[model samples]
Target chain A: MAPAIKKYGITVSIGLLAFIILVAIFAGQVAPHDPENGKLDDRLFGPCAEYPLGTDQMGRCILSRIIFGARISLSVGIIVVSASVTVGTAIGLISGYFGGLIDEAIMRIVDSFLAFPSTLLALGIAGLFGAGFINMVIALIIVDWTPYARLIRATVIDLRGMEFIKASIGLGMGDLFVILRHVLPNTLSPLLVMATTGLGYVILAAAGLSFLGFGVQPPTPEWGFMLNDGKMFIRTAPYIMIFPGMMIMIVVLAFNYLGDSLRDLLDPRMKMVIR
Target chain B: MITDERPGENRPLVEVYSLKVVFPTDDGIVRAIDTMDLSIREGEKLGLIGESGCGKTVFGHAIMRLLEDTTKVTGNIVFRGKALYSLDRESMRRLRGKEIGMILQNPGASLNPVLTVGSQVSEVLVLHKGLKKRTAWDRVVGLLGRVRIPEPERRAGEYPHQFSGGMKERAVIAMGIASEPVMIIADEPTKGLDVTVKRKIVRLLKEVTVEKTMLIITHDLDVAEEVCDRIAVMYAGELVEIAPRGAMFERQLHPYVQGFFQSLPDRGLKPIPGMSPSLIHLPEGCRFHPRCNRATGRCRTEHPEMIDTGDGRCVRCFLYA
Candidate 1:
């Protein structure tokens, strides 16, 4: 079990993720105070028996808000990654499988998108679309899918000529079935690794956008929104920003750790060395 | 049990008429198979023997239309009275694996590494035969049993990496014969296996492909002799000689064929002089003339056409002309 834990490295990360998820899911029941409702007298208060982690500028329970913020961050990470991976994988499969002119056309478009620094492109999209939840998600998705597409395309191109893929085709399997059953499954390990790592990036990007007031609105208690609100009281009340900032850092690190470990475990060549 | 209409009739199951396959590289067009003509009779096992890079595999790919679309293929490949080249992509795909199964050279690389051996074989059954999952699994285990794999039920559940070299080949053969194809194209079935394992694989392939039209491609004369009814010797990119297995061993006509036999360990270990000509810049006249002892001025200047020798044998040489 010790060796298995060391080999996988995701056990701790999975526990951390599960804890965060549980906190988010039970925020209403577990939170000591209402995230929205606040008393004027409690404003700028530090940790106490009644209000643990203290109250924010609005005198709302900062701990409760942060707990609720987990929901927003996790949802954004999951939804954005899901949408991008699915769309990107489909395009990559078609482009790499057919190749030739269709490949050329699709790849050139992917290339044009990849030409820009992704963050700058996301920023540009966010600026153009104006501040909103859906627009912010769209911006991140547009930027995020390029990596998945490129990774999947490269993998598909490498695997397209593999004997197993050719054998599947030779076995009279239709193009759709071959792509789904043979080509897609071969790309899964890398895709899984990419998605796990990409989840962290998505969460970070969503928070960045929200910090800039382009993501979930102020009243929503997202970690980024809390960070933005806390930035004002930094000198007088550093704890306000410290808590939300730590949450983001910890979640992102957890995903990164899991992703790295998964790469080691899932890679055939790497597994041999470890064993 | 999809049988040809006239099982005993004297009709060619597959006919290659002036078939040519050329690949365009950065340097120049590589003439892989140049004006090759041959035919495989129903239920006959034809051996395509050639050295490495001699277009034997390319010929098999051409028949299956497995080559990239950019490849320039010309002439006719008629299978069961239908011109294979004339068929559309979809129809051609349908013909492959179901009508003509192909076992590639390397079995290790042929089966999907991630998929279970059972799933790999069952995929063929489901795709071509439309068998349900339950039915495919039962048949897959039965097919594994037929290949003499120990504990077919347990072995089928294992991955390609879990199987040994010989077992992987057996699994690949199981997949190839899963659809019960009318014709099977096995390219280098016994290649890379040790002498003992080679015999076992040869015996296994021979057992499975019995009474089915087969094109077995290899450079091993002994394996060809053991399995093929008639052997077709390919030199450079042309069919130099094709004769019955017994006749090919007894009275080899083409100089290349003679050289190949002479180089065999049991024969003399006499290596053929010079190397196989590069497909990009093939030698003038006869491809084998540069190494031939009986080369004449005509052999250096004009390419010889394949001429019918008596007793259903054919040879390509100026001496024959």
Candidate 2:
């Protein structure tokens, strides 16, 4: 990659992610039309001045639905990531701090979760719980937390032998205090980088489940469900699938790029080229 | 500081009896600290000197009961007439930082980089004394000043990265003495420091530990002579000779101790013959027999125990036996 592209990629990724967040937060006002209420008279229409990006199979404004879909994707991504990170970090700290049988048991369980392809596991879980927004979010969180657990566990294990930690323990601080003050803060930078990429994966996974009819029910206008709604009409009106598909792809790519740039900025191993 | 009037001044503040530390590795069982006995008198400064990897640090850790659970430790450590090994987990935790403080080597690594120096020092007060944060912060500033740090009030708020090497060491020392523990174990506090810094630290150590019992572990003979009343020499996981600072320096008994002093830069600058024996497979009789210039057949086949050489001195060599 050229230096110019590398710099611009970071800028563009930040800009796009910021825009998506703003769009999600203000979906109620930014959207020109009600995403759920459709007009049969203008069904399958292509780009127009009043209803930009044309109409979908329901004759709903594709642009407005895409804007609304941003809300679900972003919220699900944020909620699931936060929940998983919290749960996983806690488990990982405990497992790594007290090694031996406890460490063995926890790591084996984490390994089992990691053995199956994450998406497939999410699919199986979502299928078991039955399709709905909450159930799908639950499924995503269950699969999502395993990676964070493993990441934190590895970091905690590395920090367990650090001189500072041993010193703190010798200072008579309880195990909990040492983990909170010494171990957790050191794990933050890598955790932040991992979370950014994890957010992108979560958003993509949620969309895939929605597209497969295991996520949010219809009339909700989620990007994945919108894609599902437009799939049957792909031949007659390609714009229906193209618009939402583009939205999902762009958002995921932005998050991934942002994560890459963050790693470069935060990673100690990277030779920082200050600009 | 050595008040003969005090009832327990002559009694041992900390005592170890037949202590051994063994680490079972894939290669073999590494006998880090062989069967050893030690005593630290109340209000006395004892310096333990040895070459690198001679189990000086391990012995320090063992005395504090800070060794890993995987290592096989079979011995008795008595602190204040209480058996340390028999203490429950909570009691042991309470004993640390309150009754006994430890100043680890590498002051830079001993402090948590993410935490402010003040907060790190204040944590000891909070945990052991149960002081509130506000009061603890005030005391932390005072403690920092006590350790010779300038502008303690302002510097206390700054993170560890802002402090220099000597300043970080002072902060670590402040943390160790925050609760005014009865005994403090300082492991090579002067190691890795330049002459000027080492002098300042040695002075600070003497000043802060005026009336407190201290165990200073170091390889610097000058440091031991300067700060310690009694000096113990360790060679290959065992004590070779222990005597008063003046006596040990003037008329040391063990060949290893004499060779050690001769190897110093200012002394004859002669290196001891042969390397220290490997701990995993130490020499059959005396651990230092291979490196001893005056070794005999008796020193080769039989391990010698510590022998009393009068005037509160002991030497673990067949010549003394």
Candidate 3:
């Protein structure tokens, strides 16, 4: 039915998601050594026997820290996006379903929140909330939710007038019930596209905050902090910066591709792929 | 299947007395429905005909209380001897789809795209009847079968996009009759269908809801003549003429009705005199004087009341004077 949710997008998305999950679940065991405990004599060793992907300036295993860092990045990203989607979708559904005064009030608030560029908003909130992973996620949720709410609200405005919605009403559903079961369920196509795409941004934003020293703190082994640590050794041991920077790019690009492909496949207008 | 109780002597099951619908726009008030009166008998197929923007659909929506909140409607719409205007939104919701169901001009847009044909049909059953999922699914198939959808079991799981135009209309029909509503208001239900498909859909609606009354809204006189027991012509937000189907086709009164029939595309089509008046600001006195070839000095000065022409036929025109 519906061509099995399309392998091209779903496969890559699920693949990356599974890989990220596996690393997060068993990062301690998967990484070869403790990220901070360095064997100083073997410091600055370039990709060789006892270590892999080269060692950082402190002689800590770059591979180990990168693998362990996966948990923090993914956790913040997933948590922030999930929280944002839930709040945004619910608000959007309520505001959009009951148009006029309710819609106007909700929209006015969303517009005011949307006034700030998302990253700047998140950074300001994160900076104020103090440096913690949970706080960063909370900050991201505040800025991120408005987009989902706005998009869903726009879509719902048009869809509410459709007969099926009327049928739902006729069938005996109250406005809230109908908005949830009928309206929200049908709006998954766009939400799904946003989810995967939004996750990458969430990941990048978390990493950026960490690199700025306002996230997770030093010795936490986040990709952004790893990159920041490596930047000082640009001429001496370039592997430190390149490796962590490469990790972010690979994951981000994979998720982005996965989102784009899934967006197309899930789309009702893409009849060519439907068969 | 027909109800024996009527409103009063020669009165119908539902009667709208001096129905008025006004819209407060930026420019001026749009008297969409200006003191119109009508009635529908139990088990009667009454066709409401009008040119574009003549307020036929709005009248249907107003009676259903499905109009926008911006609209200020003042009238006594009595159904089964109870006034309908005073009903709250929840009560109206109960009345709609349970007592009175409406189908739109576009079948494609009306049905929810995400839900299957079965789910959409069963939505009415589950909502109004409070049936369980299993019972709803079972009845969904039954309802679909009633609407002439072949291979009902398989078709139920399929989405709206899978069905053709005719099939989609049938699905909509299934949803309407799921609760066995007393009256079905079909607003141009066959507008987009080819003649053959249109004929099939009309036939399907008639077959499934034979016991229930239908207010079939259409601009086409032939469609009205085919299925409707009686025809009511609307123009400039008023009923210009009404008669039994046979009488209407054979001996019509009111020049507007005459003009509408002439405008009908008969084999090649009949030619009408002029366009319909705008509801926003209708011409004073008679709404039809501008279009009526028989318009006199008085036709412009005074509005003619809808009077019976001694054969159960009603016409609102000075020509009868």
By lDDT, the best candidate is: 1
Residue A54 Cα positional deviation in candidate 1, in Å, after optimal superposition: 2.0
> What DockQ, between 0 and 1, does each candidate earn?
0.76, 0.80, 0.41
Off by over 4 Å in 2: A5-11, A271-275, B1-9
What TM-score would every model get versus the actual structure? 0.96, 0.97, 0.92
Each candidate's number of clashing pairs is: 0, 0, 5
lDDT by residue for model 2 over B1-321, one digit each (tens)? 111123535888888878888999888888988887888888899999999988999988887778888988888888998898899988888888898898999998999888899999998999888999999998999999999899999999999999989999899999989989999999999877889999999999999999899999999998899999999899888888889899988988999988899999999999998888778888898888787878898889999988887777888888877
Candidates ranked, most accurate by DockQ first:
2, 1, 3
Clash pairs (backbone) in predicted model 3: A163-B110, A171-B127, B262-B270, B265-B269, B266-B269
Residue-level error in angstroms, candidate 3, position B261:
1.3
Clashing pairs in 2: none
Full ranking by lDDT: 1, 2, 3
Query: What TM value does the first chain of each candidate achieve?
Result: 0.95, 0.97, 0.92
| Candidate 2 chain B lowest-lDDT run of ten | B1-10
Local distance difference test, candidate 2:
0.89
Score residue A97 of candidate 3 by CA lDDT.
84
Q: How many backbone clashes does candidate 3 have?
A: 5
What is the C-alpha lDDT profile of model 2 across A1-275, one tens digit per residue? 67787879989999988988998889899998889998988899988998889998778999999999999999999999999999999999898889889989999998999999989999999999999989999999999998888889899999888888888888777788889988999999889999999898999999999999999998898999888898898998989999999998999998888888888888766735644
Best by DockQ: 2
True contacts kept of each: 0.85, 0.67, 0.40
The TM-scores that each candidate's chain B achieves against the reference are 0.97, 0.96, 0.94
lDDT of each: 0.90, 0.89, 0.82
